[model samples]
Target: MSMDELKRRLGQVSDLNAAAGLLSWDQETQMPPEGARVRGLQMATLEGLTHELFTAPRTAELLDAAGTPAGETDAAVVRVARRDFEKATRLPTEFVEEAARARNEAHHAWLDARERSHFATFAPHLGKMIDLARRRADLLGYEDHPYNALLDEYEPGMRSGQVRAVFADLRDRTLPLLRRVTAAGNAADYGVLTRPFSPEAQKAFAWRVAGEAFGLGPAFSRQDESAHPFQTNFSREDVRITTRVEAYWPACLFGTWHETGHAMYERGVAPRWERTPVSAGASLGVHESQSRLFENLLARSRPFWERYLPALAKVAPEVTAGLDADTIYRAVNRVQPSLIRVEADEVTYNFHVMLRFELELALLEGTLRVAELPEAWNAKMHDYLGLTPPDDARGVLQDIHWSAGLIGYFPTYTLGNLLSVQLLEAARRDPEIAAGIERAEYAPLLAWLAEQVHSHGRSLTPAELTERATGRALSADPYVAYLHAKYEDIYGLKAEG
Candidate 1:
């Protein structure tokens, strides 16, 4: 009876989260512009109520009654719920509501600011966001750095020191290979990707790949258009992915595949786990691994294009009139320094992530002022990618993370990149998965990941999941080795050092 009651209470929390998720989805997709004012209040009210109910003294009594669970699933439920309850109890209900309001207002302001290519319009909100982040960190308490508190929210048990060490090692090892790739003058004929295609045609081709090819069907999950591409779900059975359509086709095509990866992870979680603490991905980094694995490893591989290029031709044959598999593969894999993180090539992508990670650290540490963010951002772009943003849209305002109060989220993208390679190498070891990749049949591969990674949900930590899935601790060696091999094959330059 006690376990049953605990489950019932946890189910209520999930339902509330789903309610908030629906509000956020509508605000992003369908809500009118002026509705922002009321929407923020609605979000805050839900958030406050959610926090209060979860942290009530009654929950403590229930946990004491449940005691130590014996079974694996029951143990996980008690353990995670207890951890969350302790943390939520530390944060006041007013803080929760205020943070939600700040996030909502700032999100709308960010849309307008990015469109206008203005940072000043969003600076005050970012300041408030940073202040709230600091306040939350203080409320939560931290040992070494306040940033650790925020980062731990996304990557459990991870610290800024650990992230710094990992990124430093990655940058030291990969930058040389990146320079070699850059110095090689064999530029891909990337113009093929930027050619004009009608929006309707682009949508049809992209969703076909997402739905028919990638296994995200209309019944369980669907895709939509948003200013910035993202995937969110109220439940495993009701996943939604969104992307922006561009005149250039790669943005929509690759973006759809990227988000489909996230949707698949959410959809693949064991259905019996829904409305529970363990219903989501193990961690944001692990979640990112799925997205990156699908986006880069699978979608951009030679076999994938070989299989899907024909399908694409049937949908938008004008763009592929004279194109072949090798050309499309090379075009998609071209290594170049790009101003946008989303468009960055595989080799240079982490540099974009690293830049944001460092800037976020500085912001949280109070070493950098919010007003000086654009200048700091431009400097990092020049240092890391050898380019400078000409405007705020291309610079500090490019990402919605800060405006939406996602302070510690940027580092997970790089962690996701590293884990993506580690997980793929592990998955490919299975002969069925290996052959499935060779033949462009992803069912075996997807099934492998569903069994290995997605099915557990939050039952394990990122490290535990990485070791279980890959048979080793998370290391940059596989990722670096993968880069060296793939880029050397493409550019005819060995970056061995």
Candidate 2:
């Protein structure tokens, strides 16, 4: 088949995936409680169809027939399609459909289970998902570890052992920094965020800042609310993010900032690449870097609040009641060991991912059972962050990942945190981006990412993209140094040279 025919075929597969993606977007946003029953089958049908279309014998024939591509973009299309075909062909359509149905059913079960704080209701579903993941890993055939098979799905070319080493280094460095901050007590007045604020005002101000401050304008991108905060896109033209609003102000403010990072990156992908395999961000880790960068490196910084606080004050006067940028910055950056991963402070956040990664490995290995998850989870929480859960809602049932069959996805969160700082360091080296950031104009930074990371999409591997953008491979040093300097200043603690 010709290159055009290859792209046309890939585009058709992309369209099928897009249709399912729209259903997923609604599944999280607008679908009613009863809709989940049918939604599972609906999504499963789409999954199976896309799998069949992508993995057909003709795809491999086409991939081989395409001679050396003329450009990076075309080469990427052929290359990515081949990689996907290898994985897709490993599983039968029946397996794909079953996994999808299981994921959909488990997702709904998770929601209901979380609301009731009952793990028993969700345990059987989680077991089914875990069993499915094991079967998938077996089908995919990993050499070192079964988890690596699943991990590669989200972060291609990344291995579980590499993640383990990185996490160990990160945990060692973070613990000392967290200790100093904890020892110093609360440096920023926690009262600023802990106090009640209007949910409406919070949403409006956050949404405005997301569009204006971060450059994720609503022309092609939009924001809404969901049970959990996430960003999704059907194509570059239509990107969506959902953030939960609650009594705690940061959930709306930072959640919007985080998802805006994702939406902006999605919206920024090169238009010519649409409906191709390379259309989306490089990987979930790379995608998470954008969200982490926007959430912590940009919006969470003092420079951002310096300009936006008054705007927030305009909408919710309570936020700025005698508070200045520095005070608010310190408060939002406070080191608190929390039960919820999403609500975790920066210093302790990766520990949450580590806990989940370890738990996932165990669950996948049959060393841990779904029934024993809460106890194991509480123990890890105590071991890692010095906190215990009062209920399963804040414990095992807190995150929607496991129930949705996202077993190998947790480690990407930490990878993103590390890469976010790495990307920020690289961008700030550009005088234009640095100036834009200080002035609360994000276009330069966004444009820099568009040119360097976003535009390439999945054309480049995550490691290659990180190296090209940052001039170095992924490292925890930059992220660790970043947290130390920022927190030491906030808490008035001295750091070891």
Candidate 3:
């Protein structure tokens, strides 16, 4: 099999994947309640077909025959295909189909269970998904634990032990910071965000900021409001993103910017490799780095608010009627425990992931029963955040990830935050990035990321990509340093105990 044949096969697989993704997106966003059954069938068929196509024995043989490491072809293409093939073939076809079907059904079921505020209603489905996920991990094989297998799926070289080390450092440094922020009290008022800002105005304002501050031009991207904010790209030229607006909050603004960060990375992928494995994000962690960088580093920066506040004031006076830029900046960055993971403060967001990671690990290891999840979740939230949710809606059922069988996905969010600061540190040395942020010009930073992170796609490993971009391995130093700097500035207290 030639390189061209390998490319052709991968392209076909990409198309099937895009179709499945679109169907899933539609079911979540726009499909009618009655359409779920049909949507499930459609998703199942697409999943099965995609699995068959990608995992066909011949596809692996062709990928292996494509080229040599030293000289036969572009190493990126062969390397990506071979790597993906190895992982894809590890799980059986039956498990893949069941997992996909279960995910689609679980997503729909979760919507209802969330509305009713009941985790018990969703427990059985979640249990099955967990069982399947454990089987998947066993199939994938791991050195330390089954969770490591799932972790490798998202972060390639990352292992469960590494995440534990990083999460521990984060928890130790962060809890005290949280306590201080709470003890000192919120330095800025968030009343500006609580005013009745219409959803329509918020959407328009979010788009402007996404385009002007994030360089998410519509030619390469489209944004729509959804139950959540997410970025999905099929090709560099045709990226799709969704953001939700809160009728009484400013979180949507930051959320849009976060999703835009993801869109920007997708749009920045090297066009020549579009429709192939090498065209996608290097890894979930690296991908999160782009989103977190924009959401927390650039979008939440004081300078960013300096330029964006005035424009926002014009559209929604409530946001600026009583608040100054410092107040708005402080408000958005306030460190406090929150019920929703997506709305968590930057300083404490990892705590949410840490909580979930602990729970999911227990579930997978068979130490935690599905039926006991709500009690366990409430206890953990109280133990970790010192605040307990009043209902499952705000607790175990808050996120759609678990219902969709995503056990190992939580750590990527924290990893992304860590990488975001690390990359920003690298970008800060360029001078232009700071000047542009001061002027509310994101082109320089976006262009820099494109050259350094997005363009390489999966051509590089997550570690290689981080090193090439930030000149270092993944570490907690940047994230911890960033928290210390930002919180101390906002709360006017040393971030030390």
For model 3, residues 1-497, the per-residue Cα lDDT tens digits are 47778788889999999888788767656788999887887888888899899999879878778756564236778788888888888877777888888887888778889999988789889998899889898888888789999988888899888899999989998888788878988687766657888888888888888887777887777777666567777677878888787755656887888888888888888887778888888888998999888888887888888888899889988668977788889887877788889988887799899999999899999999999999999998899889899999989898888887888999998899898888888887988887886776878888898999988888889999888888899888988988888888889996465
In model 3, the clashing pairs are: none
RMSD of 3: 1.6
- lDDT per residue as tens, model 1, 115-234: 999889988999999999999999999989998999988999889998999999999988988888889975568788877688888877888888765789899887778888899999
Per-residue lDDT tens digits for candidate 2, residues 472-492, read: 999988998999888888888
Error of 1 at 207 (Å): 1.4
lDDT of 1: 0.89
TM-score of each model, in listed order: 0.98, 0.98, 0.97
Q: Quote model 2's TM-score.
A: 0.98
Misplaced by over 4 Å in model 2 are: none
Q: What TM value does model 1 have?
A: 0.98
